[model samples]
Target: MDVGQQPAAWHELAATFATIAAALFGLFFVAMALHLDAISTNVTVRARARVSLQSLALSVVQSLLILVPRQPPLWLGIELITTEIVYVMLGAGLRVRAGITALIAAMPIAAGISLIAGHGPGLLLQVPAIIIGVVLGCWQAWNTILPAELQTRRTVTKARR
Candidate 1:
């Protein structure tokens, strides 16, 4: 498709999110590497990290779907739905946090449906989706990567209030 054929907003949003996803993915990998031993030894940490990783993966995939050059929105829509379905399968055994990630992924599903139907906000929905994913990913990293004594100190401080 010609560059002029596609709306500027779609291309810009997709391009920006692609950048954001790449940067966040790198940060997540570093955070995980630092906490790898803790995450591996503790089942609970492993489980939480899995969901966090899944969330970051979803953000990356969603950006890629939109950034595919000149692809029709309908095709992108179909791809988003398919990706979310497979993502659900991948995170199947995970519990509440996984459920939250599933819900976060629902935005892309909705965005896809809207794009397919030729109405609604279309790719703009991805703004909130990626934002939430990055924020949650960072939150998880902070919670999962900090030293145990720091966490305990924070908890104790909070309890004193």
Candidate 2:
């Protein structure tokens, strides 16, 4: 079930697919780097993109371990951690502790999924993905509190003026 265990042709095909995904990821970062205007022009859009990218990066890691046979080596882990640090910086700029709890919660869930799937789920990884997806979705769904608090504080200060 794992990539190493697959037939030669299937392994080659999967490697090709992984290469394509990695290329696309690189292109996205390049575009993001080149177009500072997109973020500068719309703060809200930028904030959303940061959060989306954080979730996306986490999902990518999870997928690599569960769905794909390649359990990213140490370098990939380092790269992901670095990317997360950047995401955390952007998130903190938007809100003091934005995404912290969700990110923390995601780690164990992803690991649990991997453990359950036994490194190669063949197809059972889908179940764990659904479970983790629900958990993350719920966290986001309830993320309104922080924004609401900020808005309330702003309103209070405005009333005092």
Candidate 3:
């Protein structure tokens, strides 16, 4: 594919990514709703849940941005970088796994920098970023919720003793 020409492949990729991101966001929302009380009552859990939601929202927005016709590569790069920075900042207060969060945060910024520099096919870089973001989002949500659930069960067992 020529550097200057838009790849025909992007359309299908963008559509697929957008759909998946949207679905993941919906699933996360439902999960949050189910655990609303636990999340709201605990400050730590609330922060983690907020970060998780932000991560998913970032992925969904990035996927939709890819679908925009005639979007400037520079603008997309800026958007990606900005969102990553926001994610990192949001996670700053949470007791998340630092290594995983760092890796997840790095992927999108690296991809965005490549896109800004015009290193190679934009989609090639962008697609991985989206995938990583979605995976990270889901992981954060599960990481936040599972331990709380376990703790609740343990407390109930102790009370029964």
C-alpha lDDT of all candidate models, in order: 0.68, 0.42, 0.71
* Native-structure RMSD, model 2: 10.2
The better candidate by TM-score, 1 or 2, is 1
TM-score of 1: 0.76
**Candidate 1 residues 54-111, lDDT tens each?**
7667777777777777687778778877877776788632533656666677887887
Best by lDDT: 3
Query: How does each model score on TM-score?
Result: 0.76, 0.36, 0.74
Model 3, position 127, has a per-residue lDDT of: 70
Q: Best to worst by TM-score, what's the order?
A: 1, 3, 2
Worst 10 residues of 2 by lDDT: 121-130
Q: How many residue pairs clash in each candidate at the backbone level?
A: 0, 0, 0
Better of 2 and 3 by TM-score: 3
